[model samples]
Target: MNNPVISVQNVDAHYGERQVLFDVNLDVMPGEIVVIMGGSGSGKSTLLKHLLGLQVPTSGSILVHGKSLHDVSKKELKQLRKKMGVAFQGGALLSSLTVAENVSLPLEYNTDLDQNTIDIMVRLKLELMNLGGFGHLMPAELSGGMLKRAGLARAVIMDPNVLFFDEPSAGLDPVTSVELDELILKLRDAMNITMVIVTHELDSAFKIADRIMVLLDGKVVQVGTVEEIKRSDDERIQNLINRRPRSNQLHGDAYLQRLVNGEGEK
Candidate 1:
């Protein structure tokens, strides 16, 4: 197997005094689609932030293309980040810009290409994303599915080697969600891009992932192929897959202490 394109080792993350990720570790190989999945507050988004160098891990390290994000100089980090692209959950387009302008922003900021050349390139990407003729429309005019595709088009404008997608199927109709899934698979196949997708959608994960890493309460419950995950007998994994709520029996003293002190109790 090829070396992992992205690696996370013993990562621990915290927000203020609250710990969100605990000794989390994973690797993403070149051209592989690895899905990080869990329900709300599972630390999926935190892990994504770490991977993108948006936030440093409280402890541990994240390596992108064999370079430690924490150890790299700012210029080096910026260069390294050029190899990565992120499609945020909300599409994250500039409401003020037209669709074509939004998609071309990365090139405008990062490159000195002439207007004609940039326009040509942007059109090609938009066409690939099925938004070729809609470039004149503003973000407010696009449907949910179109917005997602537009965000995706912008994410790939730099031809990044790694793509980080957050909730790709979120906030869309079932048919549109399926279309987005197909588009994601197609993007992987056509571009050979390594993907780390953060999603709580089980069906979407199963459909698009080469492997799935299940996170529960800031820890990895399991990392396996789709079939292996489906066959696992872990109670937590089963509960998540079956959409059953975890039953927690509260210890009165601990609950009372936490409530009074504003701290967590295990």
Candidate 2:
């Protein structure tokens, strides 16, 4: 493609002796929504950390806007990170701070804006998340869904070009999860921001992904649109999409029967 906003080239990540990601390569275009999906221990989150520069790659390189993480100076990395926003899995907010305070934290550290400007910015972001008057409320006072929304508001407060969401639908009820998915779509369309979502929720993945990357055993098994994935003939892809039990899938007919029965019960 032309110039991807984020690119990963043969990235391999390791934690001590354990290899976490193996030769992962992917690219995210500007204004696109890409979903990374896989089962637990598939290295989806590990890959996300690499993308965010929290964890360095053992081999290969990660680039944001064409600048390699390893090549960038610490000062440059800090500035580059400010250009992106991240909504963690559980809305990692400050327990002691109010909603507005949390939202303004980034501006406080990254900009020279005065208090009045910061307050206005906070209000704008909170209002965008449909949380106009909840600014004064503590994190404990907000519900789980509200907390997620508040965290999203904070994430976008700096008007970042890229937004990273780690399991946005986790810990949410079905209806709430759907609402959050819609919100993600709206953000992409209305704000023209590139979004990278890390999620294992198949329904949510199919609902929001413009492109899907499936990770397995610390490697990318497939990367394509949802339809392409659905039509894939790869055994690993099929098993994952069909929700077959991993251990039993290698055993043949009896396991297939169990998978059929289990899916029917759902």
Candidate 3:
């Protein structure tokens, strides 16, 4: 690859002494959408935190544009961070700030642009995310989906080269989740920005990902395009893809038969 925009090289993360990610390796090429999928406690979010530089890895390294996050000084790290945008889980918008103000926060801190210029930029981004004229509304005033759109507008305010999203479809209805997936695709197509999305929604993952990386037990179980994954013979991948209940509810007898026969699950 020609210098992937984001690179995770043998990354291992821990919470206190308990390890969360184990030797995780991945990359996001420029303008590509890479989805990380896993069940709860699989460390998908932890890996995202490492990518966002919120937590230092216990071992290995994470690099943005080939510069290791651990090797950068505080000032350099801040500068590097300014080149990226993050849409945290649940939108994470400031309830006190109006949507416009929330979107303008990054601009306010990272640039010396005048108020008028910032206002224009904020409006432009809001419009891009289909939230036009709603910028003056408080986060509490908007719907869940709108809040996510506003949060996305804020994330891209600086036109960062890399964008990170956590659980983009959480708590939304199916229709709303599909809409968000479309918006993700639109942003990538229009801006040519590299995107890394953390999600467990299978439908959303197959719809939006150029490639998907399935994480399990703090390690990558499989990584490939949607078609490849769909045709995979790995038992764990099949179980996830076919929506088969392992420790959960069983779907039907046929599914159980397939599981026993190893048709999809190798």
Candidate 4:
């Protein structure tokens, strides 16, 4: 049996005095697409930071390809990160650099390849992302969807084994969002890359994910296939899926007490 490509065990995270994640656990197999979905404040971003080793969990451990994130030496961690690629929300391209330069940045920094080889590699990725002719343009010249493709080109420039995408469909129109989702599936099929996407776009998630993991109040509510998630009996899960607003319940005395005692943070 193949071991999981990514394992997160009993992770707990906090910010100052407030806990953000609770006993979060997940396993991602090689070449799998796992979509992590949650409302804002559900610890999705915090969890992504932990997965990328940008932040250590307060209580548990994370392993990528079997290497403990916290236990690895700095050099080892750097090497491990070479196998990982992250495409942040909003594209995150360097405004100062042209698209080609941005896409070539990874190869330039990580390899001793000559400029000729680097240019060829950059062209390949740009073409893969359908940004071939736009490479000469600055980041500012691109539209939302083009910027996202440019970011994705930069991310996969290294031919990483694992890819992490944050909100791939966040700001795009419906057509563009579907196009990006199709591109995501194409990349996975062609490259055999393991992917972990953080998104709340239900249609996109259902289309692209092999499995969907739902989070609520900083804890996992369910992790299952799309059909299973749709048929879930959990009220919270149903509420989230149906886009039903949470009912506001009165906690008059408790709320008043908390207000007086300054314990209202929840």
Worst 10 residues of 4 by lDDT: 246-255
How are the candidates ranked when ordered by TM-score, highest leading? 4, 1, 2, 3
User: What local lDDT does model 4 show for residue 179?
Assistant: 95
TM per prediction: 0.94, 0.92, 0.91, 0.95
Best by lDDT: 1
Model 3, C-alpha of 207: deviation from truth (Å): 0.6
lDDT of 2: 0.92
- Name model 1 segments beyond 4 Å from true: 248-266
Pairs that collide, model 2? none
Which model scores highest in TM-score?
4
Clashing pairs in 3: none
lDDT of each: 0.94, 0.92, 0.90, 0.94
Off by over 4 Å in 3: 247-266
- The TM-score measured for candidate 2 stands at 0.92
Q: How many angstroms is residue 103 displaced in model 1 relative to the true structure, after the best TM-score fit? A: 0.2
Predicted candidate 3 versus true structure: per-residue lDDT over 116-192, tens digit per residue: 99999999999999999999899999999999999999999999989999999999999999999999999988998
1-266 per-residue lDDT for model 2 (tens digits)? 56999999999988888888989999999998999998889999999998999888999999999999779999999989998999998899999999999999999999999999999999988888889999999999999989999999999999999999999999999999998899888888888999999998899999999999999989999999999998988888887888986664346777698787785341
Query: Can you list the residue pairs that collide in candidate 4?
Result: none
- Lowest summed-lDDT stretch of 10 residues in model 1? 257-266
